[model samples]
Target chain A: MREVFQQSLRDVQDRLVLIAELVEQAITEATTAFGSSDVGIAEKVIDRVEEIEILAAELDQLTIDILARQQPVASDLRLMVGALRMSASLERMADLAQHIAQLARYRYPESAIPAGLTKTFARMGALDVEMARKIVDLLRTQDPRLIAEVRDLDDDLDELHAKVFEKVLSDNLAETPANVVDSTLASRYHERFGDHAVGIARQIQYFISGSLD
Target chain B: MREVFQQSLRDVQDRLVLIAELVEQAITEATTAFGSSDVGIAEKVIDRVEEIEILAAELDQLTIDILARQQPVASDLRLMVGALRMSASLERMADLAQHIAQLARYRYPESAIPAGLTKTFARMGALDVEMARKIVDLLRTQDPRLIAEVRDLDDDLDELHAKVFEKVLSDNLAETPANVVDSTLASRYHERFGDHAVGIARQIQYFISGSLD
Candidate 1:
């Protein structure tokens, strides 16, 4: 029975890694689409949202089945709980990616990044993609070091998020209200993407260290 | 064993209702602070964030304890899963309220609601509070009717969300970039609050009906 439970856990971990890989792809394409205003790439990201959702639902079902059949406890039980949460965070990361892609799609002819703020947004996007990659690595390898790495990347993303607002509010930007609205939402989406990455990382930390902190 | 499990489930239900009540108060005060620029009320809302967080953490622990001890299955197991999800949504609702209140406090002497947006934000705030109240009622009574009601309120909130963007984008508003940013974020926060409420309602629906849809 213990060995069977371990196998179920391995299955859960494998699914989580697969979902993180998809999230990485989604954000990578999303950033590219947003940076260059590529509608075709944006559509591709949007198309995968349902796929991620379905996979997450399946994962939830699998975890619940494990709980029912194996009735895991202690660390094993925590692993199941962590799986459910990590799946939710990864699914949210996918949605944020889709939101970023939609921003690009909406402003097809016009760039989503306003003048003077393009470079800031590009850095933020790169940080998000990097964090997504680290998440995939952390899930695959369970490397505790990658957890802090993801959090440090989030700190940088937060700074860029603040910079976006600062530049937008400054009189020098000369952007339209539509530009302000789009930039605000877009910056927020990118920041939230980073946050969900941090959340997944923290969950992994909890699973490893056996502490909720 | 059955009776003890039922008691544990009731305890979980009661804690969820308690958290939901706190969330209702948080949004109510937050909206008031936002509309009137009451720093004191905003501060009150902000201070309650940790309280809600602690309560949610306690509830999660209790549910896990129940799961480990009782080993519930079938509908009982679904209820446990639903409880975890509902706790998360409720905690998120409280955070959104704190964010709204922070917006009010940030602008302090200046109102968070811009000149022409006062009425629209008021309506949105009222809808959010109403939805929060309905969530409490639904959790307490387990009446499926309240689920549909909460969803209908979300639809209205969604339209107002779009209208805020429409007015912000229109030439007639003539607002500052700061105003556009705050209003955009405020509207998004309100819309997300409603979305969380709908999420809780659906989880309850899933618990009662045995379907995830």
Candidate 2:
């Protein structure tokens, strides 16, 4: 019975990494779709969110079951609880990716962003993709240094996000309010995606170090 | 020992309601600050977010303790897990409110939104306040009608959010791009707050009925 519980716990951990991989794919494709104005790719990312959602829910149930049956204590309980939080954060990160894809889909045939800001949005999207992939690597490797690196990466995203505002508000911008709205929201989505990655990093840090900060 | 565990569970539930109340207050003040250009109120809301954060963290620790020590199962375990999710949703909602307040602060003295669209944004802010209040009432009452009502309220926010886009994109709009950016992002913040409230309502419903829908 103890072995069965341990196997289930390991299974949950494995599934979490798989969810992280799927999230990485979704954000990468979603951002790629953003740059290329590929409705097909964007649609694929949107479709993939359903799979992420399913995995998130199943992982949630697995965590709940382990908590109830194993009645884990101390570090084990903390790991289970942290797993629950991490699952929700990853699911939300996927939702943010979906939001990005939906923007690409909404402005199909035309790029979601104006001509001047495509490079900016693409940069933001690339950083988010890197951040997403790093989350997977962090989970697999459990490296502490990566947490600070992810934090620094999010700071970079914040800078890029501010620069986006700078570009949109610059005198040369001739885009419609509609374009401004789409680009700003999409930029916010990417920035938030970085924040969620950082959040997962903190959760892993806590899971290992038993510290919140 | 079981009785002691039940008491701790109840305490956690009580604290959860307290955190919800703080979230409601922040959104209320933050939106008020948004319209009035009241930097003081906005700053207060921003500072109060720290309190909400602390409460959320404490509540989380309490839930972990109950789960680890009590080994709660069935409905008790479900309630605790739901509480954890609700705490996160509420904290993010508070962060949204802070973002709203930060916008107000960022654009101090002058209104963040254009004069023409102020009414539309004010309406959206008012709806979010109502939705936040309704979340507390729903938790207290567990009335399914409240859920439908909250859903309807979110629909109302969505409409207002659309109208914000309409006003921004309308001809004869003379606001600076900076003003447009602030208004759009603030409007998005209020819209997301409603979504989080609805999420908590669904969590409550699930806690009661044990159904996802």
Candidate 3:
């Protein structure tokens, strides 16, 4: 029974990695959809939303099962808890991707983003993808130092976001109301994407450091 | 040894409640400062920032110790994890109070919030305080239902904040540039506080359900 439960734990970890991969793919697809204005790609990303949710539910059930069946202790307990947290973070990341897709859909027909603002949004998306990739690596290695590095990287994303805001408010004073609001909300979506990415890093940190903060 | 570990876990839970109490007090002081334009009370909250930080650090250490020594499993493991998350949420709540205090200090003497916006800000603070209180109760009792209710309550806050923005953009057009900017930022801060409060609930939900959705 113990051997079987241990094998199941390993399987759940594999599922977690797969979920993380799917989440990263969704991020890439959604961002690509927005940057390239491909509604078709965006739709594909949105369709994966249910799959991500289902996998996340399964991950949760797996953790509960491991806890009840094997009563994991020491490193095994940490791994199960870590897997659960990583699953949650990945799910949130996927949701953010879906949100971006919806935003892309909203901007279909006519791209409302100003050139300066679009560059900022693009940078934001790149940072998000970068963050997500780093988090997955950290999970794979359980490297505490890598988890620590994420905050500084998040600072860069934040700085870029602030610069984007300044440029939008200053350079687009005379733009249409619709254009201004769309750009502002788009910037907000990008910022939130950064936030969710940071959240993933924090979850990884909790797994290693045993505290979220 | 098992009994000692169990007692330590209980101690950690007790400390979490204490931290929540401090957070509640800080929010009350900060909100009162905002509502009354009391610079003195705001100054006091700023001074208490370190206290919140220290309490958070102490709680973190306690959580790590429990995890390390007790090596808890099942429900016991969840309790420790919950304690860690609750501390994090409380720390952030205290920081939000400090942020509000800073805002109050910036707009000192001449209260920038116009009389018309008073009701909106007041309502925002009220909801925040209520949510903070609810989280504390949930932590105290290990109640599961409040976890879901926090999300529902947060929706009301979001609606209230939107109404605030609509009111400002529509009715406060004649206001001075400084006041307009300040009010906008103030409203944003309030909205963010609501977001953080909802976050505490999310942590509680994970504690109750052992899942993050």
Candidate 4:
């Protein structure tokens, strides 16, 4: 019985990694759509969000099933709870990625980001994709170093987002109000991507350190 | 043991209600600060968010404990999971309220909603408060009608948010860039409050109906 229970738990973990991979794909493609203003890629990213949501629901049901079957205590309990929390954060990250794709699609034939800041957004997108990929490994390995790297990358994303905000608010004064709004919203979407990743890391920290703070 | 497990579950529900009340107060105080441009009220709302966070964590820990000890299945399991999801949504709702308060603080001596759209924001605030109150009732009764009411309120918030966005984009063209940014961000914050509430209601609906969608 114990072996069977552990097997189910292993299944849950593998499914979680799968969800993270799907989220990474969403982020990469969404940002690709955003940077290039490619409606085709954006549509593909948007379609992928449904798959992420479906997987999230499936993982959720599996976690509940394992908890009922094992009635795990202490560390095992924490792992299950953490899985539920991380699933939520990953789901939100995918939704944010979809938001980025929608912005690209919304302004099709015209990039949501101005040309002057395109390079900045491109940098942000790369950092975001890297963050998503690292999180997949973090889930599989539970490495503290990976969490630290994600945090550092998040700080960089914040800095870049602020730069985008400053440029759009003042330096890009000649831009249309609609375009400015798009830039602001898109930058926010990217910033939230990092924020949700950091949130998932915190949940992992809670699992390891048992600190609620 | 069964009675004890049921008691713990009830405690979880009661604590969830308390968090909802705190969120309600935060939204009211935050909007009051926005409307009056009163930094004092805004600061109070910001401080209250910590209490909300603490309560949210407590609810999470308690839910995990109950699940581990009880191994609740079927409807009981759904109820516990729903509480977890609702607690998260409430915490986020409080954070959104804090964001509104921060905007008010950032633009000290100047109303965050702007004079032209003050009435629109004022209406949003009223609807937000009402929604929070309705959620409390919904949790207590699990009434489907209350869920419908919450959805209706969210629609109202979306409509008001759109008006604010339209006004800032065109009619309020003479406003300073910073003011326009603040208005856009604040309205988005309020809209998110409704979004989160609607999300919680959906979880409740799922709990009642066992529907994944």
Best by DockQ: 1
Q: Please give, for residues A91-166, the per-residue lDDT of candidate 4 as tens digits.
A: 9999999999999998899888877788988898898899999989988888878878999999999999889868
Stretches of candidate 4 above 4 Å error?
Answer: A209-213
Please give, as one word, the docking class of candidate 2.
Answer: high
DockQ, each predicted model: 0.88, 0.82, 0.16, 0.57
Candidate 3's C-alpha runs over 4 A off are A1-12, A33-47, A64-80, A102-115, A141-153, A175-213, B1-9, B30-54, B67-74, B95-118, B141-152, B168-213
Q: Find the 10 residues in a row with the least total lDDT in model 3 chain B.
A: B171-180
RMSD of 4: 1.8
lDDT of 4 by residue, B1-213 (tens): 779877987798789889998999999999899889899999999998999999998898898888877878778877888888899999999999999999899889876665688889899999999999988888788898888899999999999988987887785556666667777788888999999999988888887778745
Per TM-score, the best of the predicted structures is: 1
Output the worst ten-in-a-row residue range by lDDT, candidate 4 chain B. Answer: B171-180
Off by more than 4 A, model 1: none
Global lDDT of each model?
A: 0.93, 0.89, 0.72, 0.86
Candidate 2 regions exceeding 4 Å error are none
Best by lDDT: 1
Q: Give the per-residue lDDT digits (tens) of candidate 1, residues A131-189.
A: 99999999999899999899999999999999998999999998999889989999999
Model 4 has a clash total of: 0
Docking category for candidate 1?
Answer: high
Please report the TM-score between candidate 4 and the true structure. Answer: 0.95
Q: What is the C-alpha RMSD of each candidate to the true structure, in Å?
A: 0.8, 1.4, 5.0, 1.8
lDDT of 2 at A6: 77
